[model samples]
Target: MQPADGINLHSPPPKLKFEKLSAYKKRKLSHSTVNDTSPPTYQISSRAEESDNSSVVEPDKNLMAEYVDFVKVKPTKKEEVLRILNKKDVTSPKFFQLDSITREDMSHWGLNPGIIAQLRDNIKKFEKHLTPQ
Candidate 1:
């Protein structure tokens, strides 16, 4: 009796196999069992033919510069601050209080206005932590 799908599953399926390119070509070229009218013919051509006259296009430097100019570089302000802060000899709130690093300097280094107060507080805390009780 057939299943509900009404499909016949009586015989085992054919086993899958593969042959080398040379063997396959020989088998196809000679007829053994395949009863097809004509065997498929493949045309292989080389792409390095000198008859090809297509020239490689060079990119415009000016056009590339226009696009590249829009890329924003990462600011080294945080690194500068960390370098100063990590200095063993320069661990004082007075250093921050000195006019060496001004609001203009912060702005030039791409630091926000709010970072000034935060830096001051961090410096104070760091100073307190470093000093004895």
Candidate 2:
């Protein structure tokens, strides 16, 4: 094709893009077969647990202070006591102690507030169970 009358307006062709596939993908394409060997499961060693291996030294106070600071238990109080009671479904007359000492769900949670902590622990266990071995 002839160039423009007073300007060279020809543009180069666009570059082609080629993405590389991983080795796992290539193997999948060659064969669709899979081995039958199962994965491992985590198990606590009862023998070790029973042993009297208490040689490890106790942690120093400075180290303990650092750890405590790292895991500081700081909970900002925001929600009212009634809101918390409403969430845990603890509306029964038996739940309230002296009637005036109601606690907030925000500061803590359900009943002794420790139930919320247990709830968090149970959730962690559930997540561990869900993981692939």
Best by lDDT: 1
| Tens-place lDDT digits, model 1, residues 1-133 | 3344433455433442445568776886666336666545443243212212223323443422222122221244444444434442333333444455566665555545565455543544443554699
RMSD, model 2, all Cα superposed? 22.3
Q: In candidate 2, what are the lDDT values of residues 1-133, reduced to their tens digit? A: 5644544435433443556889998787445434434332233344322223332334332432222222232333223333454565543222232223344532455334543333222423333443598
- Residue-level error in angstroms, candidate 2, position 82: 12
Candidate 1: Cα lDDT at 41: 45
Weakest lDDT window of 10 consecutive positions for candidate 2: 64-73
Candidate 2: lDDT of 68? 20
**Candidate 1 steric clashes:** 0
Which residue ranges in model 2 land beyond 4 Å of their true spot?
Answer: 1-19, 26-113, 124-133
Q: Give Cα distance to truth, residue 30, candidate 1, Å.
A: 99
Among residues 3 or more apart in sequence or in different chains, the pairs in candidate 1 whose N, CA or C atoms overlap within 3 Å are none
